[model samples]
Target: MKDRRARWYGGCAPGSRPVAAPVGARLLWRDPALWVCGGWQPEQVRTLALGSARIAVLGPCSATEHDLARALSAPELATVARTWAGSHTVVRLTERGRVEVLADVGAASPLYTVRAPDGAVWGSSSLALSSLTGGSVDTGWLAAYLRDKHSPASGLSAWAGVTPVPAGHLLTLGSEGGMTLASWWKPMRRTPHEASTALRHALGEGVRVRVSGVPASTDLAGMDSTTVTLLAAQCGPITGVTVHPAGVTTGGDMEYARALDVPGLIRSPFPLAARHLPFSATDVPLPATDEPAPSTAVWAMFADQLGTVASAGSVCHLTGDGGDNLFSSTPAHLVRLARSGHWARMFGDARDWARLRRQSPRPLLTAALRGNAYRIGRADFGRPKWLAAPVPKVSAPTGPDADMALVAELRTVARSAYAELQLADALGLALHNPYFDGAVLDAVVSAPAEQRYSARRYKPMLADTFADLLPDAHRTRAAKGLMVGDFHLGLRMNRRRVLGLADGRLAALGLVNPAPLRATVHAAALGAETVWPPLLSVLAAEAWLEAVERAPGTEWTRNAPTPAGAP
Candidate 1:
């Protein structure tokens, strides 16, 4: 929901004076040994207290008192947390004085832990925790992020000494200040038909809990958003917002968005003007994002859409961000089919895919016959030409090629989703992506690989599950909306602004070579087919550095104890 003052910081301190809430912060829940503080609205924070044990559920959740008690009494808390209806973070205090924090399955609701002399501290904002711990930027982590932007670095954040709780794991702190992460989740296994039923239920419940009798909004630009918009419409007053690019269009998103005919849904179409392009806001400081986000580089384009939603008083804004990663299958799925002795189906699918990409079927068949096509060895970590520093030997994904590829892609998309949430928060809007919910993810992953992909059909599983709700024009749509041209045009128009970053933070820190970096930016600005991810990553990191420097820091340390009621 829309809560501009959601920035919060809280932690447990053993044998230390109780901390007073920050001037503008609201006390969520407090005890002698633990305190949680944030600028959350009263409705946003739900708590259950029982003697020495207590639990708090933050964000949108369908958790009841019974659920909290059961979680507190259960041997493993994450199992129960996984069954919750909507996206949320769970903070629990045990009678034994151990504190546990469970973040959502996605990076958007990340929790960070920092060790202090007195006790262990945790907070939602890495920037907030960094200030209290006197943390500086972790250049090593930044380098790793640039090298493996798709697969997020485990157990590290942008701030030095700030450890993020990995997704699907619980962060627990012992009474003596020791910390550990316990495995609490795994993908569910089910047949395609069973998974379709489970997915419908999970996704429907997820939306129901968040928007029941509330004012909400959803993006109507793609299949993912269209489905979410339809669901939200069944509940209460809902706004369907769409942003159509002003310049040369790519896909039929604008057409489908305009053609939508929902009985009660309010359609709001925004045309993104030419001035609202990436790199146009290089002169302006961006929102305080924890890490480098490529989306932040293009924040200028979405300001109007987000601002308009916030102004309309919509509590929550939904997007279909994680849908592609969850539903779309890669070439590795073909490998699975070939290994299972489905020769006819494998060859047929390969031919269909080859025709779409304008390539011969020989390579696809060869790759499928080879089984796993991934390279996860140390040699896989190669330094790019623009990078000046020695690349670290980062850990690579293991297991089957198909699974590893999907995990890596999901993690990458989660990071971007989290970045968008942070930016939305800055504009007084709470952004939600239900597809990232653990249950929803499990439902998607549990389905058979063959059922999830088809070269001829577009997201067949999603389409078939919600076929009745989809428009006839969009149900069989195959083309995807592309922003490549818009991005190129933005760079060309603001070449001088981009060139100013040749000797920027990354170059000064010796991470990237100024000469090669400048050449890459120039070529990209001229609309050459340049490698976009690494180039955008460098620029994103540069912009993040500038933004963090401009933002004010918050301290989470406790205030001194009152002097025997002398006041």
Candidate 2:
């Protein structure tokens, strides 16, 4: 029986595999029967017993082999047994015919089940079961898919007829084909305050735990080193914390140097000196000086700011252009942009070549605007090129009433755009992070009138949040830092390589005017313009599609997989 079971496990013909059986039980003939077990938690097990009668059990049971043996000794033990531990679910059947099932506390793992017409029951991934049940996949779920990007909890595969066994559920199948399903666990809820306090304590403890082994003392006395140590202590233990010394090539360093040269700009605005360090700039060589150069100093002061602006601009540009191209006046713009060919248009411009050759920032701004322009050809626009709507005026709000309305509108738009951008980021499109969501923008834009007058609070909320981590002078001043524009340098340095790939792909896809895209990219690279955010999104979308094509299997059919034998 054990040998037969092993072979069954190894190579059951795709659709012919037994859905459920007791561990080590041999299938002597082709019969439609399946056993399922799921939902195990600490000190508790949820199981499904199947055979002559199907039943589900939810309670604690010792996992000892002896306990299992004794439990199986009863006459009712002719049924199959399944158990869930952690994320793994296991099934075992006793000689007497009983069945058992098991699962874990968090229930992150999933098992789906379906009963076939011939009385055969099956359980596997939702996708797999859908294939067997002849179910039609649901594309509406794709909306939910866009929201979470992960498989759903309901376990309903995109296919119809297939259903997910709820997270905390167990099911048993009987010889007569009777089936039963039951819940085995329920999550407990805590008050918001309690949850918050617990989270705070956990975060503090986590920091201490991660930094406990580091030397209690260090020779570095500078604020930057101290701030870095503190940040490391807080975030390192959680996972994936990487620390590196600031290098010259980084945008943060360059930006910092520029800021220092401007009149009245001071070093170290935040309290923690190291918070200003630029870590996101790729492979910048550290600046050398008796006292570290102010540029380097500024880098340390604004390290956290280094990666955000470029990322933010990319998202903003994509959302705006994508929204306009698809005529999506709603948040659903990302879906259309991702699906239609416009994603490619946004990134196909070659204006970066021209921008790199210019020392002035104006050309860069022009390139940025042009890259973002939704230039509909005469064929696509259904009119002559001169008939496009005049640029809408973005008039400044005139009074408190107007300001409030404007602020509310901006907040709404920003939030809507942010959610879509986050979805794209989750899907690995390298878009902006959603940190600058509506709430953050609201706070920044609505600072006290007095605070707004100061040049130190440009991004008031962000400035305040890192005030303690930066130098004192920097904390009080407001300035819009131009991070996105700096991409021109990278474009210039790697124009040939980027154009080589971007040009051919744009031509092949026929999604845009290839000549203009080529011109934009080249113009931007030569310092005559800035063509990054819009262009990058298009490139990323193309890459993503190519990646999807290369993925194994039917490539997640736009519709869900159909279940087996279903009409």
Clashes of each: 0, 102
* Tens-digit per-residue lDDT, 1-567, candidate 2: 001010111001123333334333223212233322222122323333334323222222223444345444544322222221112344444433433333322232333455654443444334334444553334333222222222121334334565544433554545555556665543233343343333223222322322333322111112222222333334322111122234433333233322332222222221222233222232322321101111221232322332332222211111111111111111111222333445543232222212332333333233333332211110121211111122122222222232232232332233223223222322222122112222222232333322222222233323333445545544443332354444565556656655664554324534334555567668777878543434553343333333323423211112222223211
Q: Which 10 consecutive residues of model 1 have the lowest summed lDDT?
A: 373-382
lDDT for each residue of candidate 1 in 508-565, tens digit (9 for 90 to 100):
8888788888888888888999767777888888878887888777644366333221
Q: Candidate 2 lDDT (Cα, whole model)? A: 0.31
Query: Could you list the CA RMSD of all candidates, in the order they appear?
Result: 3.9, 18.9
TM-score for candidate 2? 0.31
C-alpha TM-score for every candidate: 0.90, 0.31
- Estimate the overall C-alpha local distance difference test score of candidate 1: 0.72
lDDT scores of the candidates, listed in order: 0.72, 0.31
Q: Give the CA lDDT, 0 to 100, for residue 86 in model 2.
A: 14
